[model samples]
Target: MSTRPNDTPQTLIDQVRDATASGRPLRIAGGDTKAFYGEPVAGDTLSTRSWSGIVNHEPSELVVTVRAGTPLEALEAALADKGQCLPFEPPRFGAASTIGGVIAAGLSGPARATAGGVRDYVLGAQFINGRGEWLSFGGQVMKNVAGYDISRALAGSMGTLGVITDVSLKVLPVAPAEATLVFRLGQHDALEQLHRWGGQPLPINASCWVKDATAPDAPELLFLRLRGAVAAVEAASERLMQETGGVRMDNAQAGPDWAACRDQTLPFFTPSSAELCLWRLSLPQTAPVIDLPYAQLIEWQGAQRWLWAPASAAMAIRSAAAAANGHATLFRAGADGAPGVTRFDRERSVITTITQRLRAELDPAGIFNPGRMG
Candidate 1:
């Protein structure tokens, strides 16, 4: 059982004050598994791993408050003991991934489309700002608020605004049952079917469509995961199989397959010799199959897509995604060191202004992980 040191908060405040006085940047870290995310940074490491533990848990109320540095796996296990879970299905890149990193990176798994994102689960947070002032926002229960919910806003901030100390999140019970199904279909048909199913009241929890160009003759595949009440899952599974001629994937295979897709451990994620960079595009779910210059694996019912392309194709790919009323992110750079590619989506002027204003107001000294999201 990890314990939050008796003076963790005050220690954090003192460290931030010293950093501010000396004008030195501080990089906030829990397990450090998500170092590759956001812009590369330089700063003195302010380790939060020791200030870790579940602060409070009320299973009846469906809320859990945990220190920022608590290992994500530990928290999940705790919730599992209660038969509840963080429905967003946050991905833990490494065994030591912490809750703080989850909120900062804001990466959710396949269930994100139907369940929710990190921000949606966030209920409250405690943090130390640039001036070494400790502050908190929101509460344990869910409710509608008139003003901005700073706790939720911190979800994807990448630690740029402040050093998060603790957070409270809403949780849900596990579904009573689950089923996985796979179908052989082309890109167009898969997209069409996914959109069609998205409109229905099915037990669909997640999906993924993959295309392998190397195996030209091999059939393209679409994988669907159904989860809910036992009756609902079985009914939906039978109906889907009947409609799409899909095979019911055995739990032995389905479990690992879904895990691989959620953690991005599939063969598609391996760097290809021809295309070295990885790109992630987020578009409307109803958008048609794009005519890009690279192969893609569509997820989130066509709302999220992943591709492998060389660095030189970044601009063209972004342009195509933009034309489709979406944005593309350079998820990974090439092994050979590619240039002129940015890692995140470019926000419009109004959104950018709001983001900047919030950052300035929260970290006025600009000492909290500078250039972290550049």
Candidate 2:
């Protein structure tokens, strides 16, 4: 992949200004790895891949400022060199995944339940709004209060608000020790145990419960990851195994499995049939197992659930989510496609009004990613 030399924000500003003046909708794109995420947008492509590279790095301060189009792999490699990592573990769907796309998509990996979400690490942002004017929020330091909340809000905005030019993200040193424990338990038992452990001072960083499709009898298994000081991890691992009859996994063998879970490369993510759509249900961690009849994978200590079912099951799935005081998103359409279903759940009237007002203020012309989030 050849790098483009036009790494300055001026180039993006000029393009946005021209688009705004002509009243033409512009679809913001950085590497386009997450193009399937939201509703499709009809507009001329506005590429940000050319505006890439790290702007600054302060290892001691645990913050790195990088341009929007910088490759997510490159940023992770740089941080790894300094023994630091992004705590949220944002998923890189492919090698082409960009830092800007990570923020816009606002998706996090396995560690999300314990560490934080994409918004938590964002400290500042620079973007070109709908009018093609360069606007900035927050600052490089964590304590910079002015516009801090707004900067964080950009995470997961799906580029509907503005074209994110660059951002400063908070980083953390990698944990000293880690362990994965596996237990053969059903989904309900697994969730119950996780909830029981939640009240304890255990160093549980991530959890996943899935049925082994390849196994002879397809037993449901719970995988737990513990990360922290060496002593803490070891102690917790031993106690949990003793109490629950769990088996400790060799990191050499378990590391890649965890990565597969994070990146959704696990076999479970693959649709068994072309008609099955992928639905993501975000619920309270304490919510019980959903009574839906479909293949399911539970993550985030039960806060995030992935289910495979036909689009015809949309009403039942959405109702179940709503009953749990949560929301469901049509994460990925099946090969047959979900014709009329929206990707996102409808917000409450108040939230809908506030969202409309925010878009109106920042993207007055509605020229940026017109239908991407709708």
Candidate 3:
């Protein structure tokens, strides 16, 4: 079991104080597994690995508080022992991923649309702001309304707001039953089916549609997962398979496939060329097929879409996403690099002004992860 070193908090506090006094930027890192995400930050490293351990867990209360540097796998293991889980299913890009990095990245897996996102599970947090002050917001219980919004905001802040020390999150018991169904349908048809089922009282947990590249002729396939009470899952499985002419996928094969999709290890995620960049489009679930000429893997019913395109097509992709009432992000830059393409979309003036004001208030010295969100 990982243990939190007694001096870790004060050590970090002193480091932040020194950095603030000298006006030097500090890059807050935990495990460094997600270093590839967001814009690169140039600064002296402030590692959170030493402040690691589970602080509190109440099985009955369904809440766990852990030091930010605790390994994500460790926390998950502890929760599994209690038959509880983080419903958002945050992706662990690497074995060394820490809970802190999970919150900073704020990326969720397939179950996100139904189970919610990282921000939804966050109950509270403790962190060090730019003024070298240690502050805490919210509380361990869900009913604790004080400063809740601020704590939730830290979930996807990418460490630009402050150095997160620890966080409290809500957990849910593992579903009593689960199953996966496979359907051979094109993107449009699969999305239509998903939308229809989504409006019903089904146990639908996640849905993924992608072309099977390994097949003789690449055919689009939809993989759907259902989780809930045993009766609910079983009933939904039968109804979905009957209505969609889908087949049941054996858990032995389906489990790992879902995991692969979550961690982005599926064959579809593999780039065919170094110049191809991975773009993530977030649209309304009802958004129709985009007109862009690129292979896409649709998830979250239809709210999230992934495609590989060159940086040269950035404008076209962004335009299509915006036209669909959504936005596109350069999730992963190609090996050849995107000469001047920014990772995130440009926020409107109002949102930008609010973000700037928040940053100024929290990180007054601008010493923490400067330009990380851009």
lDDT (tens digit, per residue) of candidate 1 on 1-374: 44433445778888999999999989989899888676677999998887789988989999999998899999999999999999998888789999999998888999989997999999988888888888889889888445889998889899988999999999999999999999999889999999899999998999899977667687799999999999999999999999889999898899888878877888888866844788889998888988987778998888899998988888888888998899988877776556556777688999899989998998887887788777
How are the candidates ranked when ordered by TM-score, highest leading? 3, 2, 1
Candidate 1 shows a clash count of: 0
Residue range 211-237, candidate 3, lDDT tens digits:
954465977899999999999999889
- For candidate 1, give the lDDT of residue 198: 91
Per residue, candidate 2 scores C-alpha lDDT tens digits across 94-130 of: 8999999999999999999999999999999989898
lDDT of 2: 0.91
Which 10-residue window of candidate 3 scores lowest in summed lDDT? 1-10
lDDT of 1 at 192: 96
Error of 2 at 302 (Å): 0.4
Better of 1 and 2 by lDDT: 2
Please, what is the TM-score per model?
Answer: 0.96, 0.97, 0.97
Residue pairs clashing, model 2: none
Greater-TM-score candidate between 1 and 3: 3
